[model samples]
Every structure is written in C-alpha cells, then in structure tokens.
Target: ASRTETVKSVYDKMLNSIKEKKTAPPNAWLWDFIAKCSSKEDIELLFDMLQKLRIFRLSSLRIHENFNTALCREVTKACVRVGAIEYGKKAALWRHNAFGLTPDIGSTHHLLLYSKQLNDVNLLVEVMKLVKKNELTIQAGSADIVFSICSGADRWDLMTKYGKRFVLSGIKLRQSSFDMWMEFAAKKG
Candidate 1:
C-alpha cells in the first residue's frame, strides 16, 4: 500500500503549517489527525504538540470545548495502550475533574491498577475521592484494588477499615489480602 498520509506525516504537516502561519491548527484537521492515529506513539506525539501549544497560550478555546468526553476517553485508552499508566490516570482525572465526564468501570480499574503499580497512594486516594464525591456505585472488584493499594502502601488503617468492610460487604478477600492484615495485626500486637 502506498500510504500518502501517516501519523508522522500529519504531525510534520501540522507543525510546519502552524509554524509558518502562526495560527492554531484547524479544528477539523487537528481532530482528524488525532482520530487517525494507529499507535500510542502517534497519540503521544499529538499530545506533546498540544501541550506545547497550550503552555505557550497558543491553543484555541474552540479546541478545548470541542474535546469534550470523547477526546478524554481516547487519551485514557491510548495511555493504557502505551503502558503509560501515570498518564492514563492523569487523563482519567482530567476527564472527570475538568470535563465533568462520568467515570466508567474501566477507568476505575485503570486508576486502581495504576495506583498500585505506580506505588502512588495519592492516586489511589484520588480514585476513592472521586467515587465518593460523585456518589458512584462501588463494585465488588473495588475491594481487590483497595487491598492492593493498602498492601502496597502499608496503610494498615485503611486495610483494617476496608477489610472489615469487605467482609461485611460479602466480597471474598484474596489470600494475600488476608495475609497483609494478619501481618499488620501481628505487628500491632
């Protein structure tokens, strides 16, 4: 296949055109370029350029308003695909906090795993805060993520609180979760 338009090609075109004209990229072309990305790298490249433009105050409000929930969802999906869990959480948080997009179960799972994998208790706390602030339903799978965060962060108080809550909620704790609590209990005794 003789490909005329590629991600790099589109990026180069946009960059060059913007540089020459000192104008914001047209909304349609910009969104089209973003939508045509075939890999995570392309998405990151687009974000990099957008970030630079935003920092320099060259971006348009039209773009921001147009971004809406769909762009945030794309960023979340792309970040996870690229193993950029930190970025994924950032995107998810921005989507909810900035754009007022409703949180989905998948995003909850991503934030939960990202917090544990990144060893970021604050991110995990942010996830919980969002749920409570929004009054979202807590799924049983949340217990698993809470256990992981508590175990990794050594937040025994949270472990104790959520552990009892898990039992009361009828969610079976993993063996390792129980082990973490037992270890904490032994230390406290």
Candidate 2:
C-alpha cells in the first residue's frame, strides 16, 4: 500500500514492472492508485514509469469502454499539488478538444479549487476557458471558492460574473458562497 511504502520501494517495483514489460494495468486501476498515493515525488516516479512503458498520454486516456475522465481529474489534481498548473490546464484542454469529450465534473471542481487555493488567477482563468471550451457548467466546489475570493477582493465585476456562473452552473451555492455573496451585497450599498 502507498501508506506503508517508502518512495524508493514503490518506484523500484513500478520500474521493475516496466522493465519486465508487464502489460499495462487497466486505466481505472492506475488512476485510482495515483489518487491514493501521496507526494508529487512518488507520483512523478510513477509517471516516469508510465512514460517508459510508452503509455504516457498527453490527454484523453481512453480505456476499453470509454474516455477516462476520472483519471484526467486525478492527474489534474496531482499536477496542481506539484505547482504544475499550466501543464494541468493544457492537458485537460487537450483531453476535451483532442478527444471531443467533456471533462468530468469532479476534476473540474478539483482543478478550480486547487488553483484558487494556490491563488493562481492565470490558472483559474485558464480553467474557466477550458470549461467554456468544453461546454461544462461550473461545479459547486469551484464556484463557492471563486465567489469567496471575488467578494473578499471587492471585485464587484468578478463577483457578479461568478454569481451568474454559479446560477447558470445550476449547482447549489454552498453556504460559504451564499454568505460571501451576501457580505458583498451588504458592503456595496
């Protein structure tokens, strides 16, 4: 398990599998494993092994049944954690644009929240661009955080825009988002 293992042991085992040319595991299992693992250092090692195995994808990791959105989301989160925001956003875009499939909502939320927490406005804008490109409604996790930020910053325009996005997104605004919006309104008049 990732919990008990040192990075060296995990990397070595994965590398050995690559050396032996073991068949690639199912994409689902692979992504699930990545989600469970801690540390970007270990994740980078896993990705290197994947790359060496010749399965490193720029985007759109298709499986036997369908497009792999869950994996895309997990990968994006990992990328953000490691401060690889642009790379993560581009890969997500590539996944949708190149493959003609929408990004999964979970990933969308995760990417937005992570970017906001990082205080990366550029990455947040890029993620928003991707959302429009893919025709996705903003998911709640992302919407709430953005609202809070805009409110705190007194960026009335941004607050309004995010409010519209939240409404159009049709995801219920969380209490924090609602509370922030009210605070913004109270301060305005």
Candidate 3:
C-alpha cells in the first residue's frame, strides 16, 4: 500500500484501540513507522497521532535535511509535551531559534551532547549553567550523559562541578566508575 494509505490504516487501528482503552501491539508498530516519516503532511499527522496516543519515546524520530522551522517547532512542542525534550535539543542543535523555548532536564542533557558534538563552548556552558542553576533536575541517566559530554568537550570544570552534583543526587556510582570519570575528566581537561 501507499504511505498515505498505510498511515491511514494505522491511524484507524490506533483510534479504535484508544476508544477501547487498550494498547494494541500494532499501534506500537505504527508509532515506530510514523517516527520515521519525512513527509511534511505525514510528519504532522504523526505528531497529531502521537499527541492522541500519548506515545512519547523520541529515540525513534529521525529529523532530516528537509525539516523546516515549523516542523521543528512542532517537534519541539511535542517533545516537551511527551517528556521527550532531549529530542528537541537535537533539533535545536541543528537549528537555533530566537524564540525562547526553555528546555527541560532531558533537553538540557541532550543540549549538552550537542554542545560537545559541535564543540560549542558557549552552548555547553549555557546548558551547564541551566543545570547548575536548578532550573532542571539531574535525573537518572543524566550522569552518563554528563560523563559523555565532559569527555567529549574536555570540560573538566563543568564535569567536576556536575559530577559532584550527580554524586549528591544519590546516583550510586561504582568507585571504579567514579575514579574513571574523574581521571577521564582530568585527562581531557
């Protein structure tokens, strides 16, 4: 079947499942498929469906070269609503916006990755400040992200600062892991 037809079928099935207050296996598959959509209309439809279905995993969506500002805005808003703000950070890394959209902890963590990926000291520092300022929670899995970003950016100061914060957040780092992170942060710095 054509893409439109397939999406329609998936939407119909998903709507039925929602009406019955049940999650169908095929609905997950449909979400997986929709996340890959690059067509503008399809992507919008997918976002709408996402809002309706409450499917929030953004590790599956792949932004592309053709994605526009409107699409990016929609994605960012959807990510925020679904608690997938990390994905929004990836989108922001690809394109900057003058309009403020304060990223959540998940997005800040992703922004940290983007900063390291682009070697953008300014962006990295900006994200670090947000996390440091208590605007964002250093949630679970954030420690790993901090370690990776610090390793990439060779940002020992922020690493030490955030690492200490992570320790205080009650994440039990293995003694070896803690030592290794410190060593790496030092070496990179």
Candidate 4:
C-alpha cells in the first residue's frame, strides 16, 4: 500500500477503536514501523497520523507500563526528525504530566533535547520562560540539556541568571554534566 493509504488506514482504525471504546492493544507495532520510514515526508505523515489518532496517549500508556523508555525517546526523536517541534514538545510534556515517568527527566529536558536538535533558540527561550514561571526542578538529563543549551549559546547572562535558581533550589547537576556547569561558570567569570 502507498504511504498515504497506510497512514489513512491506521488513522481510521485508531479512531474507530476510540469510538468503540475498545480495550484492544495498540496496533502494537505501529510506532516501530513509523520510525523506520525513510523519507521525511513519510515521517511527517506518520506524525500527523499519530496526532490524529491520539497515538501519543497510546505510547504514553506503554511508557507507563514500563514497556520501554527508549520507545518514548524514539517517538520524541521521530517527532524532531520530521520538524514537528511543537507536537514533539507536547508529547514530551504529556509523557511527564500523564505518566509521572521522567522519560528524559520530566519533559523539560526532553523538550530541551528537541530544541537543541532543532537549534531553535526561540523554543529554548520559551522553555526558559517556563522554567522561570514554574520554578521547575532540573534533574539528571534535563539539567544537562539546559546546561548545554546555556553553554552552547554562550548565554552566561542567562546561565548566571538561571544558575542562581538551580543553586537556590539545591538541585545539583549530575556528575556527567559537571563539565557543562563548569563551562558556564568559566564563561560567567
């Protein structure tokens, strides 16, 4: 079947199941298949399918079941690959808000990963705004991503600004990310 037809078929099935309130397992292998699509358009089409079918929730349920964190990461990566930054950001947020599992540290870092991969300063800055508003805690990989973002942009002003927030919260960077903090510190000095 053509890619378009396949996407439409999968989308229709998913919506039908939702309408029927069926408890059947997800296509069970759909994302794995979607991730393997070679063309960017094909990948974007799959992302569209995901959005249309509410597949992000299905994937989130799998993550909740401890199926695999890698699948969560792969979906985020695929969303990024297809330039679905906003959707990818929303997916990352859902994984945290819905499942309570920090698939890359509570979506903040996952969104940071997407921003870094996309080299989207605007998105990064938006995340910074969120950090400011919520006073969110940065942990593990999320901390690393935020630190890398700060250092990559040479935004010591922003780093020093947010660094105070990190220090004040008593959340230390991971050992692996010490270098990034050091870079930030060095630049600030």
Candidate 5:
C-alpha cells in the first residue's frame, strides 16, 4: 500500500476507536509510525488526531511517557525536515497545552539543531524562550546545541547568558560544550 493509503487507514482506525470509546490506547508503534510519516502537508492532520485523543481521554495516554517524548521528538524532526519551523514550534506548545506534555529535551535539541543549521539566532532565541516558559530541564546535549548556536552566530552575550543558567541549574556540561564556551570566552576577552 502507498504511504497515503497507509496513513489514511491508520487515521481512520484511530478515529473509529475514539468514537467507539475503545478502552485500550493504540499501540506505541502506531504513534511512532505516524510521527515518522508526518510531513508539512499532513502535520495538521497529525496534530488534530492527537488533540482528539486527548479530548476523549483515550486510555490514559500520559502513562506512556517514553512514547510521548519520542513522538514529540520525531514530530519536531519531521517539521524541521520540511522547513516548517513555525509549525514545529506550534506543535511543541500545543502538545504542552493540550496533552499536558512537558516539552522534552530531545525535541528542544532538534529545534536548536535546526536553528544552528539555518544560522538563525532569532529562531534559536525563540526556541530557548519556549524552553524557559515550559521550564524544561537543560540537558548536556541541549547545552552543546545552545553553545554551538551562540558560537555560530557570534552571539557571545547569549552564550554567556545561557552558560550561566546551565551552571546555576547544575547541568553537567559535556566536554564539547565546555570547549566551545571556553573558546568563545577567550576570543571575547
């Protein structure tokens, strides 16, 4: 079957399950498949389906913590792949609001990664603001991405700001993160 057909089939089945009040949630694999298949055109469809699942209180969805984070990360990746960075931001906020999902580090990392790839300091700042608003923990990997973003953009101020935050938050800096921070500080001095 074609990708569209498969997506449509799964979409229909999920919708029917919600309508019929199925006690069991769909398998994690199904959600993973949807996330992997998400694209610019069909991203709204994916978001709508997720909203519906939450609205109907489908099978204690929040219980699947691992799946939820993976889904968010994959969806963010799909959005980045298609250059739909705004949609990705909206999706992250939407998941936080609608499903009570915390923005995971992986999702934040992916957005930051793309911000670096695009060399857009404004986008990097926006993603960081979202992270701050959501109070998501800054992990070592994400710190590396932020440091890289600041380094690439020649934004020493941003590097200092977030570097201090990471230090105060007690997040362990990876060796690469340390290297970038020190290199930038030395250059600034």
Candidate 6:
C-alpha cells in the first residue's frame, strides 16, 4: 500500500478504537502517525482524531511532560507545510493551552522558527508576548531564533528588548545569537 493509505489505515483504526471504547493505541504511536501526515487532508484527519482522543478521555492516551510539546511542534509544522499558517498558529496555541502542560520553550521555539521563515515581525512579537505571558523559560535556541527574526526585519528595537530580557533572565545565549545582535546593532548605527 502507498504511504498515504497506510497512514490513513492507522488513523482509521485509532479513531475506531476510540469510538468503540477499546484500548486505544499509545500516544507515541499516534505521534508517529502525526509525523507521517503530509497533506492538508491528513492533517485535518489528525486533528479530528486528536479531538476524539480528548473527548473520550482515553486513559491510554495520557499526555506526559514534553509529549504535548512534541505534538504541538509536529502539528504546527504539518499545518505550515499545507499553507495553513494561521491554522498552524491556532493549533499550536490550542495544544499548549488545552493540555495544561507547563509552558515549554520548545513549543514557542517552533513558532519562532516559522515566524522567521515567513519574515513576520508581527508573528514574532506575538510569540514573544506569549512567551512572556506564559512565563515560558527561554532557551538559547529560542533566543537565537528571536535574534534571527529581529535581524532579518531590521527591528533593532526588538532585538535590544529581547536581548536585555535574555540577559536579565540569566539565559546564556549562543555566540551566534550574540553575533547576530552585534551585527544588527552596528548596521543600525
């Protein structure tokens, strides 16, 4: 069978298991299938299955720490691939909020990467705000993305703001991040 067919078959089985109140497959298995989704239809189906898992309160599908982070990143990337950029943002935020998982830096990092890809300063600012609002711990990788975005957009103000924020938070940014910030500052001056 084609890869799509195989993925669909797995999706159908997972959905049916939930509907039948049977022991659903493990979340890791579902995550593997989620990673396999390539098309918009497949992603939509994946979202539907995720919703079913939530609604059914499937004991087998318990979300552990970092599981939701991985799931959100995959879902966001899948949606972005299908030209559903807005949907990707919503799905990521929904997954973050819905799961009650501790605010994770990885989830925001994925969003920042996409915002950088789109050269979307507004989206970058929104993600930064979300990070602050949720008090998500900032990591070097996330700081790198923010610096990249600010440099790309020539938004030295943003770079300075987040640069100070990172220093204040005692997060040691990478050399590359510092290089980008310095280069951008020199360019602006």
The best candidate by TM-score is 5
Ranking by lDDT: 5, 6, 1, 2, 4, 3
Q: What's the lDDT for candidate 3?
A: 0.54
Q: Per-residue error at 126 for model 4, in Å?
A: 1.5
List residue ranges in candidate 6 displaced over 4 A. Answer: 1-8, 26-29, 58-68, 90-96, 99-103
Q: Count clashes in each candidate, considering only residues at least 3 apart in sequence or on different chains.
A: 0, 0, 0, 0, 0, 0
Candidate 2 matches the true fold with a TM-score of 0.64
Ordered list by TM-score, greatest first: 5, 6, 2, 4, 1, 3
Query: Higher TM-score: candidate 4 or 6?
Result: 6
Q: Please list all clashing residue pairs in model 4, or write none if there are none.
A: none
| TM agreement with the true structure for every prediction | 0.50, 0.64, 0.44, 0.63, 0.80, 0.77
**Global fold similarity of model 3 (TM-score):** 0.44
How far does residue 10 in candidate 4 sit from its true spot (Å)?
1.6
Residue pairs with colliding backbones in model 2 are none
* Candidate with the larger lDDT of 4 and 6: 6
Model 5, total clashes? 0
lDDT, candidate 6, residue 84? 62
The digit string of per-residue lDDT tens for model 6 on 38-66 reads 77777767767766666555355564433
- The per-residue C-alpha lDDT of model 6 at residue 32 equals 74
Specify the poorest-scoring 10-residue window by lDDT in model 3: 56-65
State the lDDT at 78 in candidate 6. Answer: 75
CA lDDT, candidate 4, residue 144: 69
